[model samples]
Target: MKRIMRALRRCLAVTAVLAAAFSLPATDAFASPTAPASPTPVVGGKRAAQGEFPFMVRLSMGCGGALYTQQIVLTAAHCVDGSGANTSITATGGVVDLQSSSAIKVKSTKVLQAPGYNGKGKDWALIKLAKPINQPTLKIATTTAYNSGTFTIAGWGATREGGGQQRYLNKATVPFVNDADCKKAYGDDLVPGDEICAGYLDQGGVDTCQGDSGGPMFRMDDAGAWIQVGIVSWGNGCAEPGYPGVYSEVSTFAAAIAQAASNL
Candidate 1:
């Protein structure tokens, strides 16, 4: 779910410059979209049955992200401009299929951009829908919890670069490299405090790409409840070595989100 909203690469030439100073094996070299033996989620890996949060609405106007609470539709700020009737967004979750949809139409949308978010990145938005949507509430991680290596992020975005609708929600897991490893590997490409990078260094396959922005980076705890520790923001083309995908720190913004939730 990479976003070009706030930090449209069009203007940030130097941004992609430093990160490209590295590379990882391409998809074909590593795993096919559906190579079963591959760890984490191989592309074409079995998509999670789409109805968990049947109420979970995926924002799809100019931006795309999953909706959690009915009143609180979480998304990246790049999704809205607060203008235009053509800004049509669809909310569908019963089953993942982007071929064509009569997804629940959002009569109106309000974008509450996250404060102090990355100015040149896709770290914004926690929309408040026009009405309360009846959906199961997903758990938000309360602690700064994450394990080093082998974690996953799930979403309904393009499985491959410029590919078609991966209508079914999909998951991709890669080794989660620590901050030091991330910095040592990505240098300026990963700005600490603003971005946290993760993925396998050796096998560049399995990762979150362009369509995954604003999706949840899940961490399963001892109890089995999935806690969202980060939000899919951006990355340098899926699973690039030294430079994995970047996530918005959930702990950093949890309190603000809690406050926002109270309003809902």
Candidate 2:
């Protein structure tokens, strides 16, 4: 019984660390929200039609991203945290289903995390492709305030906690939650400048899940073009009550993103 208990304790400790490091699984920690499940996909999202989100990309490392440019992709820092230029990470996009032959696959040649990313916050990252992809890129949110509107997040992540990765992309519409309400839900875990929270406050049916990390939380602009406002970061659980999904606020790093892309 002692050996069994020890093993269980160790497993729990590891789980807690992983939850803090990325969007994998949930734990009871105050700031350490769950990370997406390994090889799993989004939760409580509906099937997305092809060409609906042309900028969506699936990271080979079980995360999601948006095509920012011909060669630049935007995702969460945790998704490529310790990875480098030769990490064998592939960016697959331009298709709704993973099995489709129309999907464009590109190898990531470089990975750059935002400065001061400490695993807990500032979760955005930029990936450089080996070659340029010709598909339309998603615009970053600048003048718009994504703080209080219905936004769409799509990924090939788990549909439920501890589930497998989705074969096709899944999308969910989540309402923005104010900072005070979000802080009430996450307490010290909420980083106001770096993170934004969104989901149902009363019920718990819609959110991003495992393998959804680094995906885009976007909205249509006045001209009807999709603008990425957030990058899936972490949360307490998959659409759990009171705990909305947290994302890296794109507006907070808009200038940084432009500078980084320009330098590269």
For model 2, residues 1-264, the per-residue Cα lDDT tens digits are 332221121111234434543353323211121444332234666678888888889887777889899799998877765545654788888898776778899998888888877666677889999998788899998754655689998987665664455557878799999889999987877789888889998897888876788889998888888888888888776778888888888988999989988876
Please tell me which predicted candidate would have the highest TM-score against the true structure: 2
Model 2 stretches with alpha carbons more than 4 Å out: 1-41
Best by lDDT: 2
TM-score of each: 0.72, 0.83
- Residue 1 of model 2 has an lDDT of 35
Q: Give the poorly placed runs of model 1, Cα more than 4 Å off.
A: 1-45, 52-56, 82-88, 98-105, 118-122, 147-149
- Name every residue pair that clashes in candidate 1: 1-211, 1-212, 1-213, 2-210, 33-43, 70-133, 77-124, 96-167, 149-176
TM-score of the candidate numbered 2? 0.83
lDDT for 98 in candidate 1 is 36
